[model samples]
Target: MLIDAIRIYCQKNGIQLSTRDKTLAADFFEHPHDYISDDYFNYKLHSFICRSHAELPEIFIVEEKGNDFLVYERIISDFCCLSQHKQQAPQSFIGKKIIILREQPKTLEAEALYATIKKRISGANLFFLPLVAFSLLLPFYSNLFNSRLVYSSSLTSVLYITIFFIFFALLEAFLKTSVYKTVVRATHDNSIKISKLLMYILTITSDDSAPSTTRAIELSSVSYWKAISSLMVDVALLLVFLICIVLLLGEYSIILFLYYLGFAIFCVYARFQSYESSLKSIAINNDRLIDSISLHNNRQQVRFTNFDTLRHAFYVKSLASEKLSHQLDLHNNRWAEILKLNTFISMVLMYIACYLAINTGSLSIATIIAVMIINSRLSAAMIASVNGCYSVKVNLHQIKASLTKLTQHIVLANANQLHLDKIEQLTLENITIEPHGHATLAGYNANFTRGNVVGVVGKVGVGKSTLLRAIIAQAALPHGAIRYNQVNIHNIDALTFQRQIAYYQPALQFFKGTLRFNFNLYGIHDTGRILAIIKYCCPAMTVDINILDDVDADALNFSAGERQKIIISMLLEKQPSLIILDEPTSFMSDDEGLDFLRHLIAQHHDAIFIIASHNADVNRIATTLINISNTGKHKKIFINTPRPTVPITVKPQGGLAE
Candidate 1:
């Protein structure tokens, strides 16, 4: 099956079979399992197949029968290979024999993956235990030779101990390096999985419910490093605490042991309190800063007197944020001082304990020295561990919060076998339109077919836009189903369904790019048709035929009416089956708006045109008018005879849709 898919792809792209290495192809086919198991072998075979090409292939075909192995039409790009093409670009693969491969089987859920990473980090941290033991025992062992307490001073004994220490230290270093590399590689691989999962969540989530663009990026990329660092510190601290316990058992000094243990516990408690307070302060400061920045950014939108008031408010927020930040810094400094004082006290107690042990002859001179050294190390490790635990707590809290926000409102729907070449006979079976959880339109039933113009009219905030959003599957329909050719809209693949739609709103903005780039944003590259449409829409506005001029900056150097016309022209260039417009002519003059509407209706006579507007002229031009009341009910106001609800039969295609 994979071979057949690859053959079809090559044939469609006009790649000659004579160019392919027949020997490599035979090897790939005969021992397909071997190639599947070995990524290097698979890459060698696929590379030979596309050796004649230059640009990397955007589509990949994978065998579904056994171990899924991808065959690229061109050489794979670095990013594609690194990400493993986890999310397929459905539109790019449309009309091509491309098989969408599943991501690696070991990919876990976001939370599970985080847990696994933590476990691996902890395992890697175990390598530090031996090193910690060596450090603690070294002082005692070295002092033993100097004092001649445990063994008599001799060259053989000294040499034997020196070699053993050297050999063990080197062995430990190598083991640590190997374990660290393994953990690092695993973490890198899992980070990609986390990113993919987060992207998928963002794609499926509605814009209103999703995180801000900055926050999404932070969660997907920035948080991975923070998480790994925090986990390492957390695990290291745990190992330190365990070593402290071992020291207590070996020394048989309960008082000293309890003192250090109590100090470690106190540090943890103090740090947790400080971190919680600091986090709250940081959040408040961030909110204030954002408020001030937002006010300044939108100063142009405010009136002169209003702008003065907003400026004052912005100053107040800025001052508050600065003050809060300063206070937080002071608080952190105070905690640092307290920690230092505790450490000093801890060292003093250790010195007094050692002096008593020496006076009572309960411990040897070497043992006293070792205790002093271990006490100092334990004090430092405890302090470091407290900070690490705080960081781990905060990072995990953020990750969990982001996961909850994304998952809470997601509505899971099964993939269905419905594809539409051209949408015809759109039926709204008692749909309840709701935007942002507020019901705006209830039990609205409508059937639209080709050659019909639908005008939706309503008062301000009366749900005209919400109705349109419901039709496009952007807003949720809690009560009913929207069907295209007798199949539910939800059942149709989104990419395939949207291909036949051209939805335009007055709020839509263009990316910062040239006219050609904007026009070709939706895969429409006919320069002649684009120029013709621009000419037709705005005759007075002469645009470059080559369309190399940049329009996104300063609203493309066009007036509001001109920009609207250009946007309309861009939409018209799509030649979509369903055209949805919301207050599309709000910026244009009445006569020009009516004229444009007439031209649009005439040019797309066979298409379904749905326009939501308050203009009487639009109502006059429309065949069916839906009047939505402020109470969220729809009243049909027919302007002309509606088209017959005849379903257009389209052949269903298998697999996923574009």
Candidate 2:
């Protein structure tokens, strides 16, 4: 009820209230007059709407009091640029109707995406608070060594020290295990979350917006997590105690500790230098390997076919690999340097501090021996901290960069039970789809209505599959546009828009399972429908064996035509509004395929069919035929079969356009 009222308010004013805009609108509606003049809040709301809805091909004119003139006024000064690309910004606000889109409230950030995991991880680490307190009490337990302190007997003091040592050790073990496990879980969890989110952002949109740095960041995030999770608080507490006691011994001990720490920091920085180089090298090699696989697949191509080109490519790859190996070796050398240098430096520094203390009568021999033991542990902790910093540095930079990009495209579709409205007509206007800078299909204009089966006939590489992909809003259309029910696909809720249509490619990989297991794709068990489809399609060809068996052999026993029937049966069973099949029965004969196609088209008159096939028989059984050409040539269609005379209408099923 609140969303409907808000939607009415938005429609009256020409604002496109997107998936995240409803929350801001509601906040604004609380005190409408106050928010109208509240410049900062209005600015934030405007920015959010613009960013989240940037994927859509519409500009928003948020009619607020402050900065209305400056909102859509991004000036493109180049006259030639403006003329060639007429769709350039606020100037082309001609005959376009503005509809305000509204959606459920959602958090718009990378951190917001992982908010639940982060909160749980943070809460779990709260148990480490007692560890810090325990570290503070460590000195009290070690105080039995103080000769000046009066005790009943030396044996009694030894017993007290041993009992306390055992207690703290057990406590330390418990705290360490808890922290370590939490750290590892957090690392892996962060890795998986970032990998999926980053890949999603890359795969869905085609703006070349995702950077290589974003990939590098998510790739090695787990290692960085592991490195940082090691607890250093207890080690820090020990250092603090050592410093306090040594200060009483002599100031020279303090100087020695500071010197040792400075050297460790330098070693850590140098170690990180090698790590940074190695990371880049590893990433580059991985990219090259993927590229090489593609190159090998297309080895017969003009450039790749040349012997010289092949040799040069291999030479370049090998050269890069050599450099990577060299960097890795350098990293190893630096690690060894730190290990040996720290130990040698620790001994020297301890010797000098002790020598100075004894010569100046600042501390007794027994106190110096205790200080020696403390120095070793202190040095070890410093080295561990150094290593931890190196690992964190590599991952933290990329994580922040990825977060920044994800924050920009924050479309969160978390609503359950989304219903799709019936699409009356799907239209494409001058849609030219060219992948990888090569022209495939050009100027594809058509209208698809329910009950009308449009057969797309084209030669190989004529962009039939590309056109199918573009129609379903799967590929980004930079040249032309597509609309469903006269509304641009991008203007609708992305999740709901996707639900209305289904595209089935010819190269389908069916899971090796029983016919019953494979057919129930939506996890909806309908044994009766499966049996009926088999009976209608393949009644005569009866195998005198059981098909209900849930074995891999039973599923793979079906012939190519039989498998196609099964796939078609499964897709048709789902009853999607629009179905685009790219050569669904390429392996089957044209006559046999026509029988199935005709039956499917006639049976499901409510759903529109767009089949791309080479069969001429398809044209006779379809309402409209699309003959594709790459050189901007169009062919006439021979449509013999008339479509059902069903009136079409666009119904609203959600707050925004479906």
Candidate 3:
């Protein structure tokens, strides 16, 4: 159990060990109590060596704590120079606890994770209350137009109201800035968690029905609170303004309010009718525009065809189509114009009502003007409230759909099960590979053992790469089972199984960072091993030892062959148990390709190699060959020869030079 914890920690942290050290560590773990001097054992074992030591020993200590184990490491300096007597004595050393081996924490569901973020940012909603309250003061402005007060008193009143308005407006602005900053900080802090959630979803989802990257990002960063808060604030302000209007102008205000309410209902209905159609047209046009831009960026293809004319015409056409879509949507949705017309009609009715009230001696001129001002403000608030409600409904629907898609195909792992230490045999039992349209391959059975190089050969579009994907569990196998050491791949821990496998394809990408980062992305940081592999695979290329040079802007400077060689070298440095290569030497010359195959067959003889290629030389070097036909049938050919168990040195004579 202690050995398993140490091995898992090393794999996760990218630590590599030599063959001798692995054997020694395994033996020590089996008889750990024999080496300990204490009577109680203390559930602690120390002095186990790992890969981090040079002349001195790097000791690993494991302490059992209930169901889990805590692992620590300590480096002893100049231990070789110490006297034998001193080495025999009991030594005490402090170690740094590196990791704990326990059940991984259960990942929170997408809805639950979103709710936690919403709760943290919900404090920003309180700021809307003050903003709505400040808006209530707009109705009071009608007092300034009154003629009863003296000039000096009226001027003083205007000055005080202006001051209050400015103060409240500034306060609202400050609160808005604070909320913006808070949201930004929260988003930044939770970015890693959000990324993990996205990866988890992708890992468990089928390849054919995976969600788009843009949609996933949108769902991960959705802020429904913005629309909800806006709706609530507008509704509250509209209600308060209506109440004030009713209190000031009794029956007339009620009649005007009812009229506006009916108009608002009509406006909402029109908006709903036009909203979905507008969005669909815009989305389609946007996709077309994006495609045109991507085509334009590929200057090579266009230059060979029409010398920039085709790209220019395509972009122009897409842009015009997008503009037309936008114009049509705006023309169809006339809710904003309808609201403006309602305001104008309400103003005319208010003037008529005021004239009647004044003639009947029911209201003074100043009071009538105040009622007109309140009515106008109420109409404006009602428009905003209706728009806010529409926005909230649209956003809520989108969020609900995104969340449902995210959780629909989730595959949860059993935390109580322990991972396998090593994968000895992989068996594919009557597997069917259904990547997309039709079933590419079906009823295929194969068994792969350690130290066997299996070559898969097929013509273009014959599902060679798909077969490799199925083996690694990246592509779905609908009609069969893939087992690792007799256990189904799905039942095993995904991370643990992936750690023992390395996959290389023709379309592998490098990130926009230093070469060191790209090389050590999987945690193998042995400088000597990396330099050696680079020298052997790419003899003509030169690079810095620290590898601080950027590979972003000038990545194209490296030829395709050079990039493939560098990526292959990095993969070999990991020393994974299973290596899957798909058309690995498509960019290399025949001589270079042959040399690459010879080198792999010689070195790393203990690993299981699955190479898919059309090169005849690759088939000649393999112990077993699988030929896939056009009808999705496969024929397995076995070469009756002993598998090579010793490493041999081979050098490339051509290709990958400069």
Give the candidate number with the greatest TM-score.
3
As for lDDT, the candidate ahead, 1 or 2, is 1
Question: Using Cα atoms with residue i matched to residue i, what is each candidate's TM-score against the true structure?
Answer: 0.68, 0.64, 0.69
lDDT per residue, candidate 3, 1-658, as tens digits?
5555555444443332233243435554444333321111111122322223221123333333464444333212222111112331112222322233222324435566445444533456666666666665544555643543434555787677678777877887787678667755544444444454566566565433234532544553454555555666777777877887667666666667778778788878876775665555544554565665567657567657875676687677676767767666585556667766887899887787667667777667777666766787778777777777766566555544455555665656664443565678888899775444345567878898899899998777767898888788776666898888888877777444545677889988675576655655644345566567666766777845644343452343567787787787677665667888998898999789878877876777888899998677888889898776576434454579986677555549644432
Candidate 2: stretches off by over 4 Å = 1-157, 175-219, 231-242, 245-248, 288-323, 397-419, 429-446, 478-481, 494-499, 511-523, 527-563, 631-658
lDDT of 2 at 328: 85
Candidate no. 3 TM-score? 0.69
In TM-score terms, candidate 1 sits at 0.68
Better of 2 and 3 by lDDT: 3
Question: How many angstroms is residue 568 displaced in model 1 relative to the true structure, after the best TM-score fit?
Answer: 4.6
Worst 10 residues of 2 by lDDT: 38-47
List RMSD in Å for every model shown: 13.1, 18.1, 14.2
What root-mean-square deviation over C-alphas does model 3 reach? 14.2
Q: How well is each residue in 55-162 modelled by candidate 1, as lDDT tens digits?
A: 123445644336544544332211232114554432343333324322222332446444543443324544545555555456656566557734654678778877
